[model samples]
Target: MRWWRQLSVVLALLCGCATSPGGKPPPEGNGPPPPVPDTLPWTPCGRTAIPLGPAPEESDRGVPEMVDGERALFFVAEAGATGQGVWASRGTRGPGSCLVRVLSPGPTGLGPSEATRVGNRVFFAAEDPEHGRELWVSDGSAGGTRRVKDLWPGKTGSEPQSLLEYNGLLYFAASDPEHGRELWRSDGTDEGTVLVQDLDPGPEGTSPDRMTRGGDGALYFLAHFQGLSTVLMRSDGGPGAVELARVPSEGGILESLTTAGRRLFFVMGHLHDPEMHLMATEGGAPTLVSMFAQVGGMAALGGQLYFSATTGKAGTDAELWRSDGTEKGTQRVKDLRAGEAGSAPGGLTVMGNRLFFAADDGTHGRELWVSDGTESGTHLVMDLEPGAGSASPAELMVAQGNLFFSAEVTGRGREPWVSNGTAEGTVPLDELAPGALSSDPRRFVRAGEDVFFTAADGTGTRKLWALPLRPQGQCGASASWQALRRDVVTSAR
Candidate 1:
């Protein structure tokens, strides 16, 4: 997905319905039976907080690069006052859990977005007063943070994007002024960091985007050949990137490139075309699974690929779907909202034996829904908001066997919510901000026993926060009926 809830509006427009980005529209018929609220209110997570400075707004871009040597996550975060640089976190809850060492101190930031870890060092792009924003590498410490190479030296940065790690090398696309935009590989050193081959000769580069890794240990990316033509290209550590196939680009389509099993799966179609096809990278000429399915987000679970797609078919439109890489295998999982109301599930995530997503099944509005890969087994997990106004779940990430997402309650705004797929297990981390503002947590990166993330403070400025999660591989299915009967009472209201 490009971001969150863009799929909601896309689905609404395509299916002739009205589903808000933050909430759901009322169904045609009567709503479902009113849910019996449990007694307990919002359960607060007694977690320690660390101030990693100011982000000013919620950016779903704080990436956590794994530093294997220190068993920590090396990331770019804002700290102190207007200082954004490389910082490391070991994922512990106690003192000194957060490490704030500014690698490049600047007013705006070091501009480290996609930092990829190779051998314990993270390679990323950081801003420098002398040299704009260029490629830099860090070893999780101050002394080790430095630029790898100035591809376009002296403030004219080779602004790089899509840091991909494979075969002991880092691959990405950078815009070198003379060479245009081309693929480059690095071995985490200055001498080793050099341009690979130029796909599109000079300044008017191929403009590679959506760089994805396939099952066969090769890179699959999209590049603009002329201008209107979008080509699917491949590079197998070869002499240069080559065009694999030509993809139709009517709406800048098929960016959700994901590797499911041995094949790379993504969407392909224009905006108004209801015949959006779900295709794979391999399997001979790309199989078209659905006639009108625009898959927004996908997750591989239980050896099958599950995604949220807008099928434009009544209740099944914008609901959960799965594929076995075959036309017969690809079908809507369930008509979750009955006949033709549209459940419209998004944020597809898999935990343990079930698939968890945020859906409005006409009855429960927009709450958490879970499935066992069967229509009969797919049902509502809990009603967090309890009415047509939804607690829409997006940015679903799994940490310590539980699912964490951003949800909006009436008074709470949108905050970090934790759920183990149950009524009582679903709750928000209720910590006191400055006032009524939300600690809108996003960009979760799990390292050791902690999840490092960013959240908006009471003053509507973004800052870093951490939650010490349960141990990895621990089953998070902890919701007693007595507990649900208690928490649902006040929490649902």
Candidate 2:
């Protein structure tokens, strides 16, 4: 999988669903569905502002996992006397729909997490009194939710990490008494769930990690050895994984395993000595792309990989760059900040044909910027914070053809904002915290017609908030626009 899909998978793993003792029974009729308005509103999805986490204590609900295109499954953490487990929402059916608490907590709190869906079921890791923390699967029902297998046998759970689906099977990094922490795959059954390979053989397994899918539909990952080195390995669902390349332990830190432009890319060594490497899907020795003083976020568009980095050359200090999977083709797109300060472009998100990122052009602080893979086409989208003041837009996500992110305004604090890649179109979605307090909306995921996020409600506890995929108004105009207008009016008074 590419970076975006990989990120979505990781985010989806944080929440899950099951039937719980603390949950209320499903509501009666969902009430007549609200009349579809000309423009959508920034309305809360559940019947009430159900604070998954109690007051004064922020909710531990991370990212959500959507099922059946309507319900959202999330993990709630223990707070005070409250139990921790999985909770589900009754879709985007207006005020009548409410949240359903599923997956009862264990003695030490179930801590249900790393949930991913495959076929008709969702696979996740959770803990129970009888089985510590092990692999679990749920069909969105009380009876259907149960432990898949006790990989570790007892209280010491297998502790599965990096849950990924490849070839209709779920692959993860798990530890067992016999295999240590090796690669394991499952078909949602005890018998079908078994170790893929012993990589390192004995008790101390290879500790395979960063498992991701390539363009060719093969699994690629990094496996670490005791004190020797880390090897890049590829697997085609075969009996054994193939080692492609190795980096000595003292060589440098090998990280950022990404697939872009139909090629697998990674970085080895950095700051003083960094080398960007790429390997072809046809299989061969990895080729050195280029070296950088520093490298940050990366994304691919039109068969070209765009990233933020400094070329280690004079007057180059972390600017926007693009690569065609070659040393010569990799070059800086522009020096938005002029001199050596560089734009330091991050949050590289591909919305439509342009790349949106957070960058400082010296005069604009760190505001929203866009590029079409060219110097002339790349420029500041808007001075959201006005003079030198930064909106510092982050968490950029493309939803319903518009860019959604959390940005700060001088008086409004930090809140969610939506943009159409234009100066007039970029506007604050809502003053979620009211007044100047920031709700700090984040973890944006678009499922079905609504985009869900986690934010504070001025009560200090973060709760679920969502808005229509296509809202009406001047800047995502909706009933929420009135909130921002009210804030401005009050400020004028």
Query: Model 1 compared with the native: what TM-score?
Result: 0.78
Highest TM-score: give the candidate number: 2
**Alpha-carbon deviation at 490 in model 1, angstroms:** 7.4
Per-candidate Cα lDDT values, in order, are 0.63, 0.66
Residues 211-315 of candidate 1 have per-residue lDDT tens digits of 777876678887776577777777786565666567555665564677877777777777676666777767335556665544676888776789876655442
CA displacement after TM-score superposition, residue 475 of candidate 2 (Å): 15
Superposed model 2: Cα runs more than 4 Å off: 1-82, 94-110, 251-253, 270-282, 313-316, 470-493
Q: What CA root-mean-square deviation does each model show from the true structure?
A: 12.6, 6.4
lDDT of 2 by residue, 242-278 (tens): 9888877665445566777568777776334444343
What TM-score does each of the candidates earn?
Answer: 0.78, 0.81
Q: Which stretches of candidate 1 lie over 4 Å from their true place?
A: 1-70, 79-82, 91-94, 97-110, 240-242, 248-252, 270-274, 313-316, 339-341, 434-437, 457-461, 470-493
Question: Taking the candidates one at a time, how many backbone clashes does each contain?
Answer: 8, 5
